[model samples]
Each structure stands twice: as C-alpha cells, then as structure tokens.
Target: MSPGDEHDSFGGVGGSGQTRTRLPEGNSGDVYGGARRPVRSSRSLLAVVGVVVLLVAAIAFANRGGGDPADAAGTSPRKGAPAGDPTAATGVRPVKAKTGTIPTGYAHDEQGAQSAASNYAVALGSDGMFTAGPREDIVRATHDPAVADDLVKRLDASYSADFLTSIGLDENGTAPSGLTFVSRTVPVGAKVLDYTETSATVEVWCTGLLGLAGAGSTKPVTSAWFTLTEKLTWTGGDWRITSSSQTEGPTPVNGDNRASMADEIAAAVEGYGGFTYAR
Candidate 1:
C-alpha cells in the first residue's frame, strides 16, 4: 500500500451472511489476502466489485410446479396496527424441486415472494458465485428471460481472473490446494417490501459465511450480516428474480469470544449441517 492511498474498510454485519474486510494501516499490504498485490487501484476495485456481497447479481431457482402454496388471504389488522409472521415455516416445502442446490417453483403470492427472496439470497451469496461454470447456471436460474444473457456477461467480468487472485483463489475460483473456499448465506428473515399480483419486492436479512478456510490461509473464513433486496416476478409458473441489490447493516456489536483458529472454524463448518431456518 502507498502512503497517499486511503484505507477504507468495507464490511456488512446483518442477521448471518456476508464478508467484511479490514485494511490495516502502517505500511500494511492489501486487504484481500497476503503479499499478492491488488489487481487494480483499491478505490476502483472496491467501487467495481462492491465487495462481492454487494456484487450486483441475482439468483433464482428452476421453474417447476405441482401444487403451489399460495398464501391464504386473511383479514388485515385494524388500521394503524401492523401484522406479519416474520419467522415460521408452514411445515410445507415451498418449491417442488431444486436445480442443483437451488430450489425451484414458488406460489404467486406474498408468502411465496418472501420464500423466493430468502432462498435466492442464499444462492446469490453462495460459493458458486465465484466460479465460472456454476455462476452461469445461477444466472440462468435467476430466470428473468429478458436479461439472463446480459447478466451472465456482467457477472463473468465481475468475477474476473484478477479479482479471484486477490482473494487467494485460482483462475477457476478454487482456493489453494488444501483450503476450502466457503461462502454460504443464512437468511435471518424476509419481508415483503412491496407486492402486486404479478410482481413483488422482498428484503431478506442474512448472516453469511465467506472466505478461505484452512491452515495458513490468509483469508480465513468469516461471517457477517447484510440484507438483500430482490425484485421478483411470477413467470412460467414460478417466481423469478428481475433484479436485486444489497446493503450493509442493521449490524450488532461484536461478541466477546476470541476468533477461532482456521482449522477449528473449518471443522465446525464441515461437521455441522447447520440450523433450520424458517420463512
């Protein structure tokens, strides 16, 4: 790092999924990893990449439907009072099937919109977004027929060779031989930001895990929170993402526990299947 270059740390702390990077002062090097130099000027890189978490991409499931789970219309609360079920599962699976790990098909109603947004948040923030093959498929699944091609091209450019290297990944976005590249999003909750018969805007609050996990890995796996806003439309018998964006925070203070060793963290991530998340 040069003396004149400014060091600004960009991070997100939400309900569970994102990455936060800190660039220390005093002749310290890049924020991404060890001695590898940044591929572009720090400011331009940050502005262009939006720190991956905010990388302007959308994720969607394949279209498949059998029995759609529509939200049963119910009376609203008397004026001035608010009403909602922020966290609860219907004991019903929202989608009939999945494409790879991505779920497919959703009802054309408010509940389904919330479910789609929450699940897509997970896929968009997943490790798959870093690699080429899966990235293309993910965008395809984003399923906005009008924009899929453009999105694929834009995403390819975003996760470029230099960007991958800065984060200690290879051309294929694979972590160094022994390290496990981890990126997963856990949606804390979802809200119907806006709704219409054929379209809806939903916000998914997430706490995500990201980075390389293994001994001697500079980018040790870390977790943070952020919210993803997805605009979706009911198309081809399912809900598809039309567009999306992200923002940091509603963050909480750090906990007292010390940071875990790289190996320990990796083990926990592997051994634990994870907690059940409700709609």
Candidate 2:
C-alpha cells in the first residue's frame, strides 16, 4: 500500500452553465448535469456542513483534541503503527485537485474544510479511487498518517476480490478487455461546518457514476448520491484526510437521453480520460 491500508479506501462542488442536485422538483431541489440527476435542498446542504463539523468535534472530543502543548511541542500522536509504516508527513502532494467547481488547497478555515471534504468526495468517487495504488496515495495525502492504514484496510475489503471481478476487473483492478471503468464524483456545491488549525470537518454532496463502459458491457453507467463526511487534519502545511465514511442517497432521477451504444460509451470512456479536477 502506498502509505495506508486497503480498508480506508471508502471515501465535490460546482457551478456552471449547468447545475445538478439531489432534491426533487416539488421539493424545490437543484439539478446537476452530465448524469442529469436531481439536486440537493438548502436544508440538505446545511446538513452536509453540519455533518462535517460534528465529525471533527466528535473525533476531537474522543482524542481530547490533542493538547495544544503536545502539538505545539511537536510530541503529539505518534505518526504510524508499531508493525506498519510510521505515519509521518510524507511531504508529498495529492495526486490531483478538483471537484466540479470548488478549488483545491482551500483557505485553512471553514471554507478549506469544505474544500477538503468536497475534493475528498471526488477522490473517493474517482476511477483512481478504486485502484490500490492511487487509493493509497489519496488516503495518505488526505488523511493523518496515524489513521491511514486503518482506512486503507477498510477500503481494500470494501472493494473485495469478488466485487472487483463482478465489476469486470481482475484482482488487480484492471477492467476486462475493451471495457473502461467509470467511477467519478462531480461536486455541486460545498459548505463549511467547523475548523481549527489542525482539524476541520466538511461535507460534500456529490453525484457519481459507478460501473463499466465498454462494448458488450452489461453494466452501463449509473448515477448515485451520497454525502462524504471527511475529517481533515493539517499536515505539512496542507489539509489531509484523517477519517471518512459514506452512506446511501439523496439520489436523483435518471435522465431522458437514450442510452448510447456500449461501444460508443466505451470509446468515450477510453478516449476522454477524466480530469484532475480544479476549482
């Protein structure tokens, strides 16, 4: 693993000429494009922020938020596990930055927290998010090294051997011949909940695609919704993930467009690779 375990693998904002949301129309929702899903409500949006703040507070409360003296003295939590790689600021940058419209490297406050949460969502939903190599890089980049292994292990299991094969890949995460895997999160908007110098919580509501696109492919692109609750800690002068979780929808309706041919879809997936999203 790059720096963490597989379990941690489980892990966006935007605006444009087009918009997407999770709420229904009668419910006064918003709509995001590409996938053509329903939008999130203002109250739901607030929930996103609330969830993030509570995450930090809960974790901080659990760890006593680390004494200022210990952190200030640079003797806080030890960076790694006894049997695993020592958790230290790797001093490496995240693989890439982006989530629909939100920028990476957000300001180190509530906004930054939201940015981290949003981008973390993208990282979680990204195609690379499923593979072990990129997955570990993202975990280490986004999280406190102390928790990286736990998260990685959890992710590894989440994407088990059977799961990968079912999704058209071998044990190594490679998609079957002629198939292009598509799992990406596009952010709609973001909000901040709470933040401190070393810790922050943020929520990112996102629309994602999870499936394979290819000729003769049975699994076509599909949409999903879930809020990513990310707990972030500052490391090496940048925000990284400490811990995170995912839950089901807030999903929206499917679009009216006729499904494209599997070959066309596959070609698109292969020809147009994903972006390293930036605000």
Candidate 3:
C-alpha cells in the first residue's frame, strides 16, 4: 500500500421591492406615446438608485470571505444561542461501568450514541485490536448482540498472523523487544446522521497515531485522519454498534513542524492519558 493508503482501509467500517411614484390624473400619459408615465426627478431617481446600490453592496459585503462576520469580530456566531459548549465539560455524568477500559451503560439518547461511537472508534483503532483477548473484549463490549459474534470473527480473520507482521507486529501481535507499538485514535468530533428511539447512526471524525515507536523501527509512527460511521442500536438500555465502516480523511495538509524522535513519541504516549469523549 502507498504511504497515504497505509491507514485508510477498514473492512467493516431575502429580496427587497422598490417604491412606486404617484402621477397627476391625466399626466399618466407618456410624452412620446399614448400613455404618459410618471416622471421621477433626478434626486428621487438617485435616492432609489442609491438604495439599490447600498443593498447590493451589503450583500457583497456579507458574501466576502465566506465566513460569518461574528467570527472576524472574534466571537462565535452561536455566541448567545442555546447550544452545547465545545470547550465546556459535558455536565452529563459519565457511565459508571466499563468493560476493560471501554465505557459502558451509556444513556439512551443522541449524546449517548455519540459517546458510544467515539469510544468505539478508540477501541477499534487501539493497539488492543491487534491482540486477540482485548480485541474480543472490545468488540463484545461495543457491539450489539445480533452482530458482535460475526464482527469478532471478521476482525479475527482480518488481524491474522501475517497481517500483524506486515504492520511490524509479531505473529502474536506483539512489538519487538524494547519497541512500543502505537495505534491510538482520538475523536475530533461526532455527529448523529440519523436517530430514532432504538437505532442511531453516528459519524466520528478521528485523528490517529499508528506504527512503532522505538530505535531502528522501520515503520515510524504517523498520523492519519478518518471518519468512522457506526450503526448503533439502543439495546439493553445503552447504545451498541450494529455495524461500522471507515473511510479516509477529511485530512488537513501536514504542518511544517519538525518530526519528534522515536523516544519522544514513546515517552509522550506513555505520559499522556486519553479522554472519555462526549458530544
């Protein structure tokens, strides 16, 4: 696969009106024809023209830069609106239970669906997915009963002994001695495409780090962007994935920053803890 293609694939984933002028009873006839139309004075004409010109100018101004004027004014367009704060903590409490680091028992709502999707993306893109035990736990924890078994089987086949080696993992999906195999995904955001009482579809935009972090590692860690769409069901009082599919990128251009050393990357990963994402 091409470098760009390395992390791309997933097997299962108003108008205004002008004013009118009044004319004298018989003067309605035009000078050159049978009917005399009302004549407008230069000042009146200029006033009307000026209003039209101002209207056009205002429209052009609003269209300029294709962004909200409020944004240019250093404020959000949604400033006073009743919307969820992206920077604020979601006041809704987190799930109390977890299945081996994967959050469970999400509330049965759109927010719950989004939370479930974001966490599932992290689980599916984790280093655990490379191993059998954790992979089974992840799949079972996040998927609905109707499809969990099938998904586990598919994932087991996908992450085979040979597949692990291709991605710098051993036959048992372990990194070489002293090396840290990194496969992590952070959800940029999530949106519910469709929602119903029992079912919901959520799309999660994610940025991921993948590959090995250690000396002499051939596949150095790299970043990739992808969107994962999950079809979830409100089963057993929480949202669970019925199916999921992945597609590459809404990726941004790489910045001109210097690449960190392997040790730095490994240290950073070890030092930082991940978040429990919410809508």
| Candidate 2 lDDT, 163-204, residue by residue in tens | 466556778878787777666566554444557788776655
C-alpha TM-score for every candidate: 0.70, 0.60, 0.69
How many pairs collide in each candidate, listed in order?
Answer: 10, 41, 8
Model 1 CA deviation exceeding 4 Å by range: 1-84, 89-92, 274-278
Cα lDDT for residue 60, model 3?
A: 20
Error in Å for residue 108 of model 1: 1.7
Report the C-alpha lDDT of model 1 over 1-279, residue by residue, as the tens digit.
001111111121122322311111111111222222111111233443222233321110111112211211112334753344534446555566566656667766787787677666666666777778987786667556665666677668767787677667888988898787666666666778789998888876565666677898876565444567777888888888777666543333343355667787667666544322324
TM-score of 3: 0.69
Please give, for residues 2-115, the per-residue lDDT of candidate 3 as tens digits: 001112211111001111111111111111121211111111111111010011111121122232222211112244533322433456764656776777888778777877
C-alpha RMSD for every candidate: 14.3, 15.8, 24.9
Give the best candidate by lDDT. Answer: 3
In model 3, residue pairs whose N, Cα or C atoms come closer than 3 Å (at least 3 residues apart or on different chains), thus clashing, are: 13-244, 13-245, 13-246, 28-36, 29-35, 29-36, 30-35, 30-36
At residue 99, candidate 1 shows an lDDT of: 66
* Candidate 2 local distance difference test against the native: 0.46
